[model samples]
Target: MTFQGSLPADRAQSYEEQRASPRFALLLRAAKLVGAEGEYLCIVRDVSETGVRLRLFHSLAAERRLALESAAGERLGIEKVWENGGEAGFRFDVSIDVQRFIAEAGPYPKRPIRVGVEDVARITVSGETTVARLRDLSRQGAGIDIDRHLAIGQHLRIEADALPEFEATVCWRRHPSYGLVFRQLMSLEELAVRAFRMQPGRLR
Candidate 1:
C-alpha cells in the first residue's frame, strides 16, 4: 500500500528494572535498533545507565546482540531484555552517561536517521526506464547507484518492490552512487515497515 497518511501508535510500557539511578524521558526521539535481520526504527521512551525503553515501529527480530544508533551515528551495544505490545526494553553493555544519551553526544553532528538496504530498483526518466541499486534511505532522501549519467536536479520516478513509486530528483552523484531527494516524503512508520519488507528471510 502506498502510504500518504500517518499511523498512530499506542503506548505499551511494563518494563521493570531493579537498579535505578536516574531515568531520562525523551520526547519522540528517533533512533535505530539494528540487528542481523535489518535496521528497525525505534523511539527512545526513557533511559537510564543500565537500561532503556524503546517504542518499536515494526515487529522485532530476534538476535543474539543488537545495537542502538542515534541520528548522529553513535552506536552502543545492547542486549534485549523483553518485548511486548509495541514496546521493548534493553540493557546496555556498559553504563552510559545519561546526559550524553539524552543530548545525543557523538562525533558527528545530529542528522536524520537513514536505514541501509540492498536491492535493485527501476527508474523512469523522460519515458526512459533504467535499473538502479538502492543503498540507503531516509524520509527525505536516498542513496542510489545508477550506471547511466544523470545531471543534478533532474527529475525521475523510482519504483521498487518493497516501496511505493517515488518521484525523486537527483541531488548529487559520485561515481557509482547518486543522491536523490523524494518529492513526496514518506512517513517514518511506512519507511520502517517497507524497510522490514525489503530484507530477505527476516523471521519475526
Candidate 2:
C-alpha cells in the first residue's frame, strides 16, 4: 500500500528540480486514476514526458498499477512512484508529449478565457441522466448549474448541441453551480467558434 520510489528528506521541495524533462504547471487540468476500487478524480498539478504529480481529494488504497486519463484525451499507464499526504507521483509506461499537451490545454494564461452561456445540456452520471444549464464554457471545462448535487470526484458524460458529447469530472461544486474539467480539452479556436455561433450578440 506504499509507494516504492525513494523519498527525499524534505518532500515539500519541488521534485521537478531533479527530473530530466521540465514540467509545466497545468491550469484547470484534471486527471482520473482508474484503480482497483474505482476511479478517483485528481488535479494534475504538473506534468512531464515521464510522469505527473496528482493531488487527490481522498486517500488512495495501495494499488500496483493504474491508468491516468488527461483532460486532453491522453491516457497513460502509471505506477505509483512516490506519495506524501494527498499528493502522489507516478511514472508512466511511455513518455508523453508534454509540450503538445500544454498547447492543447490553451495558452499559459493566468486564467482561462470563459464565455457566458445559457444553453441547456444533458449530463449522465452513474447511470442517471439529468438536465443542467451551461453557465459558462471554456477550453478546459464548463460551469454547470444543476439541481442535483454531485460528488467532487464523480465522472459524468455531457451532451449539448453546441458541444460534442465528452467525458468530464466534477472538480468543484458550490450549491447549484459545479465546475467540471473535461476529459478532452477543446482548442481555443474551437471554443471561440462555438461561442460566436451560440451567442452572436454576447461574446465575452
Best by TM-score: 1
Whole-model lDDT, model 1: 0.80
> Taking the tens digit of each residue's C-alpha lDDT, what string does model 1 give over 6-94?
32332112123313557788968999977887777788999888888888876575663789999988999987766777787777888
- For all predictions, the C-alpha RMSD in Å is 7.7, 15.2
User: Clash number for every model?
Assistant: 0, 0
Worst lDDT run of 10 residues, candidate 1, spans 10-19
Per-residue error for 62 in candidate 1, Å, reads: 1.6
Off by over 4 Å in 1: 1-19, 200-204
Model 2 CA lDDT for position 173: 95
Best by lDDT: 1
Runs in model 2 lying further than 4 Å from the true structure: 1-109, 200-204
The Cα error of candidate 2 at residue 41, in Å, is 29
Q: What TM-score, computed on C-alpha atoms, does each candidate reach?
A: 0.87, 0.45
